[model samples]
Target: MISGETTLDVRRRLPGVPAHVGIIMDGNGRWAAMRGLPRIEGHRRGLEALRGTVRAAIDFGLDYLTVYSFSMENWNRPIEEVADLMGLLKRFIRNDLGELHKSGVKVKVIGGRTDLKPDIRALLDEAEDLTRSNTRLTLIVAFNYGSRQEIAAAARALAEEVAAGRLKPSEINETLLSQRLDTAGVPDPDLIIRTSGEKRLSNFLMWQAAYSEFVFLPMHWPDFDRHAFETALAEFSARERRFGRVTAQGQNGKTKKI
Candidate 1:
């Protein structure tokens, strides 16, 4: 928890809330391990984390919140665990879609859908359709997402475009490649936060997060409360986003830009 802070103070302290924030939710299995519970149970508790994240992001005035729900490599986990995760995802869609829709949270699953069960796919479609036009907030779930896979898919798309003579090979610039990504229309994340002390990207949003400010927290994903989110936002607000150029406030506001 932030020390000696009021809600009003926190709200007043924002230089500017980011338009987009990405999260790599880590340590669910470890969290469960610590409690002597099954890894799947850890993922269940992680859903609680998801609930907090959704509401907190909305409260923080973020336009988009993208969560790395499941990576492509996660398929290597035990089949029972995978089944449990899929089951939980299905349940969330069934039980929470109405509430999410009512709150104007647009749910989008951005990744390969080929390997998912038909029922899960149907739930995703239903959730997306129900909240398609929601403007309050957009929540993107990167299930079975891999940055390399995304890049490969983009390359394939480009190849097809070139083969059809719709685009010149030389015309495939950065923007063209970005447009082919799963997050095509969405703005790149201004801040990427990973909870439970991990420092690696673990193959999340590789191409899009070239300049994103990163925050790593020691708290487990299930333990990430609103205060943890506020702390992250506070940390972000303190930094000068110079992109590549040095800013007048330097990066952390302690040193002056020369």
Candidate 2:
């Protein structure tokens, strides 16, 4: 967590803060292996880090925070490991849902749910329904989510519309395709932070992150704290985003589009 010293810094206020931030929470297994502990322990610690991250986001006054919780490909892992992950997800929601709701944090789950067990699907629905009206921050849990799958599903939906003569192929623009995705209505992430030093999207927010700035931290997910979040934001604040255009300094020393 950020110390009291930096918590009140005026520089950390709005205007520069990212309105939406996405996180690729990685390195839990590796962290556990390094410490000669089971992977489950690492995942457990990662949950604690998640709580810290949520608090940090609230402290920073962020509007949205999305996390890569469980990827669809994770189902290919050993049965035991998969079971452990499922157990942890259930535990986290059952134990922490009330706290999140009381803090005015809304929960949104993104990904396909057709194959999920009845109980798990119900729990996910309950989480979203319970905190749908929260205002402080929106926490998106990308469970069973893979960017490629998400994009493909959107394309398939558009194709079906075209096939049914409900929409024309020429009308399938970027905006339309984005609206079909699960993240519709939510703004594209302004900054994406990936922990554990690995560089790559790893199938996270491929289409939505077209212009997002990335910050890679060497610390593992279980070690992510408020200070780490602050460091990423600091890096983000230093970079200039041009979004496919050039920014030139004008005669009056003001930034102007070229």
Candidate 3:
């Protein structure tokens, strides 16, 4: 357990420890390829990394941890790989749900569900329902999620409301749109980390990441550990988040456009 003083010291040094953190778990296949092993091996090891990261998140006092588990684009992969991925998902939920709930971690899944198999959908719903009241941390799994599709769906819903004369077209705003998103009621991530040196968002949380701090790591997803997580948080702490306006230091010192 983290002592009070230790926690305070960490906070003092890493003041920017984000309340919500998002991760793009990339490089599984590449890692496996580099090792001359099947891609499934890398994915399997990545699952182990994820388990460790969840425990780390709870210890770090993070309120939300969002992971890009699967994407809408992932369906284009070989059918066998997809089946393996689905199997892993089922295995993780079946094996970890009870432990997660016991540790006060809530599981929240974001993404489209209409096309998912009934069993997969049921497992997701069961995870959420089982841990709805947990307060320690929320593990958001982005399965079959595409930022563009999410945005389009929200727009469609709002348009329907307008067509029904229940709302004005001009009444639409960022807040309204956000409420309709899969991540509705969740705080926007303050930091987004991508492994394997990837520097792009790749359609993950495109709209919600407008002001997020990004950390790209050269290590693959399977190698991500608590230390790596802390390193990213420390990097975030060292930077100033100005949002859109210049900081007071920036205003008084060398003026650089944001």
Candidate 4:
């Protein structure tokens, strides 16, 4: 749970805001371990954080938000934990899908769909379909996602297109590859925030976050709040994204894209 703070404090602390935000929800299990709670309880708390994040993003007027829900590597966790996670996920969708739809939040799930059970997969499909026409915000959930595997899958798809004469070998370009990625049609993340102060990408989105401004928050996932979000957004807004070249424009705070 986040510390006690008045609403006025959060409003006063709000600074630069971001339009597209990505979060690596980390430290749930560690938080539980520190509190002597069951690991699944940590996941539950993380879900609570998810609710907060979604509402905050809406309140902050963010256009896109992506969360690392279940990575492909997480399959190695204890079977009981994995099952419990799935159960929680199903319950979340069942309880919140209608509300999310009403809120006009578009939902999309990225990564391998084969690993999920039929019912869960169906639920995801339903969620995405139900929210396809929504325009309020885009919420991407990366489940069974791995950066390397996503890139490989994109490569394979491109190769197939070439073999089928749908695409010339010379037609393969960054744009084509982007369309092949699981995040096809989605814009690259502008701000990537990782909780628990982690600095690594951890196979989240190698291709998508090629140049995202990063924020490493010391707070755990369950501890993050609107204030933390505002802090990260402010820091990101203060940065000058040079991409790969020096800005030819005078080094004034004005953004001059390379």
Candidate 5:
């Protein structure tokens, strides 16, 4: 916990709260190993943490929350573990879908769907469809997602358009590429939090998180709670986002252009 004095200091210099936050949920396996338990138990606890996080995000008045649930590279893990993870995913959706919908959270899953099993695809579709109208919060699940693949796919889409003469090479820009990505409708994350002391993104959102503020927590995903989130937000509030420009305060309190 931050000291009261420090909290007050951060509060005074605080910037605006983030409208969208992304999380790289990490360390379930490590957490389980430390406790002499199976990795699946850690994942189950992580789900509980996710539930609390959704409620906390709503309570904090956040608009969007993105979580890295499963990555494309994760398929390289042991077959048994992979199967367990998939089972947990199915169970989570089956058991918690109704409650999530009732809480007014719009579920959006972003990633490649071509290789996913039919049943998994159907479950994802149902989750999105059921909560399509909810507006309280948008929960983005990055399952079977990899930033490089997403970028490559987007580029291929743009190339196809150019080949078809629907778009010129000169007309292809950042905006066009972004529109082709899976996260086309979603705004870029303002803050990204990673648990388990990992400092890297691991290809979570390479393009979208171009300038997002990052908070790396020492605890694992299963241990993340509202207090941890508040701490990250407080740390973020203290930051001065210049966005490549100089602040007036840095110019002897005089307004200046970069």
Candidate 6:
């Protein structure tokens, strides 16, 4: 939670605000270990941070916010920890779905759902169906998602099309591949923020984040709040995003192709 004074200092519609932002929430276990608390407690606190961050995103007038909630690799963790995570996911949807819907936050779950338990899949489906009409903020949850797997799946689908003579081998391109991914209609993220001071994507949105600006924060996920979110956005505002091209200022006030 952010203090009232800090909230007042942060502008709602600040300049250079990214239309779409992605986050990699990390360090739940470490935060708990540092305090001699159970890992589950840190995870519970992290959930609270997530709730605050979502509200912050809405207040900031963002169109899309993607969170790396759970990855395919996460299943490698201990059984108890994994179960705890699943429990938290269920709790989040059950407890917060109504509020999210009322606030015009549409939930979109990406990644594989075929392998998830039937009940879990049902909850995810319910969240998306109920809030499909929302327009204020699209909260993308990357559950059981792996960027390599997503890319491979896209390629496999395209290959099958070519094999069936429905598409030519030469017709396959970046746009077509992007359309085949789980985030087909969504635009790529403009900024990616990671908590816990970690400096990696961890197989999250590799293809879509080709040009996204990254802001790494030293604070753990449980400590993230509205103030932290605003701080990250402030950093993003200071960055000069030129994609792959050179800016006129970089070329001594003369525009030229690199």
TM-score-better candidate, 1 vs 2:
2
Each candidate: RMSD? 4.6, 3.3, 2.9, 5.4, 5.2, 4.3
Better of 1 and 6 by TM-score: 6
Model 5: per-residue lDDT, tens digit, 119-152? 9999999999999999988999999999999999
Steric clash pairs (candidate 5) = none
Per-residue lDDT tens digits of candidate 3, residues 1-258? Answer: 255566534653455678999999999999999999999999999999999999899888788999999999999999999999999999999999999999999999999999999999999999999999998899999999999999999999999999999999889999999999999999999999999998999889999999999999999999999999999988987888888977444756875655
Q: What RMSD value applies to candidate 5?
A: 5.2
Off by over 4 Å in 3: 1-14, 249-258
54-172 per-residue lDDT for model 1 (tens digits) = 98887777889999999999999999998998889988888889989998899988999988878878888999999999987899999989999999999999999999999999998
Between candidates 3 and 4, name the one with more favorable TM-score.
3
lDDT (Cα atoms) of all candidates against the true structure: 0.90, 0.94, 0.93, 0.88, 0.92, 0.94
Off by over 4 Å in 5: 1-15, 250-258
Q: For residues 1-258, could you state the per-residue lDDT of candidate 6 as single tens digits?
A: 356544413543457888999999999999999999999999999999999999989888789999999999999999999999999999999999999999999999999999999999999999999999999899999999999999999999999999999999989899999999999999999999999988999999999999999999999999999999989999999988877887554546765545
TM-score of each: 0.90, 0.95, 0.92, 0.90, 0.92, 0.92
How far residue 105's Cα lies from its native spot in candidate 2, in Å, is 0.5
State in Å the error of residue 139, model 4. Answer: 0.6
Candidate 5: deviation at residue 215, Å?
Answer: 0.6
Q: Count the backbone clashes (under 3 Å) in each candidate.
A: 0, 0, 0, 0, 0, 0
Q: Kindly indicate the candidate among 3 and 6 with the higher lDDT.
A: 6
Task: Note the residue pairs that clash in candidate 1.
Answer: none
